[model samples]
Target: MSYVDLHCHLLPGLDDGAATYDDTLRHARRLHAEGVRDVACTPHVKRDEFPGVAVREIVERVAHAQRRIAAAGLAIRLHSGAELAHADALLLPASDLERIAQGPADARWLLLECPFDGIDDDFALAAARLRELGFGLLLAHPERSAGLLAGDGLARLRPLLAHGALLQVNVCSLLGNHGLDVQDAAVRLVREGVAFCLASDGHPGSREQTLQLGFHLLLRAGASSTQAYRLTQANPRLLLRDGVTRPLFDVEQRALAAAA
Candidate 1:
């Protein structure tokens, strides 16, 4: 079975992902070996850090890299996308926003980075404002946020789902690749059915085998085989269409059954 990665830095030179065309090809081969058929080329759109990265530029570069991937005979498909910074998401002009957005034209979606350094008050306002502008939010690696599920934590995170946002947990975080807190948070989110999907969020230095490891860990950490498919495959494919998220009731009900 193939998987779709909603958040991955497979495109070269835009961020900390692939450095060159060769690097991009290598990442694609690795992803293909791991059974990933589709990947979103999410270069960083953080203005302060990656000020030169533009929506049009990212799209063009992705196209160029895609041609290389095709010519190389890799079966991987790369979709043009960006991981928008909190401030950039709110401040970017309408034209840029339109060009960068994913999903159906009527109901688009954007991947907003949930800062690992810290969470700020403006994060909520950005989510609200973005929703007002008619784009769905798919937060990147929210479980790795520094202040995970603290005093205002669940208060902040629960609203993501309430606002129709999808919380994407990184596969590495689940395997304790980030830290204990992140791993714990990842587990909690999955157990509570709060995590909408699990993504490789693969970058240059990150492990390529996370897809296989993530599937195994998800099964060990409470997800059934069917539920793991939903998290890694079914839910992500819907990300391009209004950031759709379906329930993991199959596993939840199974747990309930076991409890009863």
Candidate 2:
């Protein structure tokens, strides 16, 4: 099955991802070769960092990118998305949320960027607020978060899971590119069935964005083919197709995104 990547920085000139249109083309070609047919152009959306990245502009960029990639005869399909900052998610308008949402209009699934520095008290508050505002969250790179990794990591993770947030482990973390700590957390999340899916979280030509290598590394890291396919293919596909996906492979993850 073709892989569907939900957290790719494939759009050029947006955030720290692809730098130019040509860079995007090269990235698309590589992804196509890796059997990735669909990609989400998830640019960073943080008030302090990417303050100028408006939702309307992201849509326009994706539309322009779709045209460019198609003309290049690449089979890759592009979708609009943004790695929304927790601070911004609390204030962005409902209409803007709908525009940058992952799946259909009714399915408000937000790719919430987990803070790399340290997850403060507001992280859970933001997640709960988003859910209350009718948005499902895909928490990015929890394995790398200093807050989640320090002292009883799983214990801290439980509250977020109870809040209906789905964990998205980065592919690079699985391969130990981030460090032993990140790799261990990532593998443990999968083994314990806490992770909801695997994402490239790819930006331009970064090696971590290389899905083929990441998949192989995951295999070497002790994930079976069934787990790999579920993480890379089935779960991601369903999330993009329907906004919310069920845990067909992990019973422990079943409580994710369920209505209270």
Candidate 3:
């Protein structure tokens, strides 16, 4: 099965991602060559930079990239989304949240980027607020946060997971590129059934350095190709196609059973 990169910085000139359209196209072509059939253009929507990347603009840019890729004969599918930073949580209105919660196709799942700190009560509160406002959250790249890897991190994250937040870990964490702690935490999360998905989180220029390396590490870590495929492909498809709602996980079985 072809992979679906759920957390990629592919939009050109949008934020700290691809600086040029050509670079974005080059990254898309490379992803296609690596067997990624679907790529979400998750430009940063943080408090610092890219505060102006509205949903409409993101959609338009993704459409433009799609056309360019098609014209270039690349078969990869480009989806539009915003990586909502934790700090930006207080800044976004409910409507803006709804807009970015889904993709261009209005898939209800939002790609939510957590803070570098870790899962905290504030995050749980934010998750609760989003839930109340009617959006499913996909917490991005938790493995990079030292706080999340500290004492009883899983315990700290349980409430958020229970409240319908899905954990997304970058494949780089599993490759030990971020360090042994991140790699160990990632593997432990996978083992404990907290991690529901894995993404490349590939930036344009760094595609070759991260994307394939993450996939290779997941495969070597004893993830059956099918299992890995689901994380990289099926789950993302669900996020892009399903409406906003918490995904149903069979916590007892340590697997996602369906989308709720």
Candidate 4:
């Protein structure tokens, strides 16, 4: 089955992703080979120590990359998006925010990345503010946040989930590319019904086979075949189409299952 990647850094020379036009084309072909036909070229926006492109420029870059992919005889499709870091993302103008949405001009999905160190009160406030602005938020890599993994870490994410924010886990995290802790969290999120989608989050030098690997791993870790398909394919498609999530594992039941 073809997959939809909601978070990938495939744009050339924009932030820490593909470094050149050639790299962009190569990455596209690789993801296509792995069954990823549709990808969101979601480069980091306003991240510390990394240069983020403006939303308009990011949209333009995706278009340019699409042309290059077509010239190279690839059918991979690219969409415009940005992984907005919590702090500086607040500073982006409303117009730029409108430019970076995935589908139509009114698409509500906004891919957001919380700090790697942890999620705290301020970050939650920023996310809440974004939601208030009418965006249906999709969180990126909550597994990597140490604070979210500590004592009641996953518990804290429930309120956001209840409010309509979907979580997107990195496939590499499930494969231990990050670490055991992150891998554990990733698998648990999928198995317990907390995470809505699995993404490659691929950069220039990463593996193309992660989509397949993560899918199988999720099954091994207790995800049903249907749930596996949902995370890798169906849920992402729905998010792209509707800018909202409907994971096979019910979000409302997560806490109940965990408590039991």
Can you write out model 1's per-residue Cα lDDT over 136-194, one digit (the tens) per residue? 77888888888776645555755555557777888888989888988988998787766
Estimate the TM-score for candidate 2: 0.91
What global local distance difference test value does model 1 have?
0.77
lDDT of 3 at 1: 53
- Candidate 3 global lDDT: 0.73
Q: Tens digit of lDDT per residue, candidate 4, span 1-260?
A: 78888898888777877889878877777777777888888888875657547667877778888988999988788888988888855777667776776654455668988678787776788788787777778899999988566656667777777677778898888888888988888877877777878998888765454576778888888889999899889888887776653442245346445633
TM-score per candidate, chains pooled:
0.90, 0.91, 0.88, 0.91
Give the higher-lDDT candidate: 2 or 3.
2
lDDT of each candidate versus the true structure: 0.77, 0.79, 0.73, 0.78
The 10 consecutive residues of candidate 2 with the worst lDDT sum are 251-260
Q: Between candidates 2 and 3, name the one with more favorable TM-score.
A: 2
Stretches of candidate 1 exceeding 4 Å from the true structure: 207-209, 245-260
Model 1 residue 114 CA deviation in Å: 0.6
TM-score of 4: 0.91
Q: Write the per-residue lDDT of candidate 2 for residues 1-260, one digit (tens) a residue.
A: 58888889888886888889999999888888888988888999897987667788999999999999999998988989899888888888878877888876666588998887767677777888888878878888889887455555556667767656778888889877888988888887777667778889898866436666667766877878988888888877878877753343233346333312
**Candidate 2 stretches greater than 4 Å from native:** 245-260
RMSD of each: 3.7, 3.2, 3.3, 2.5
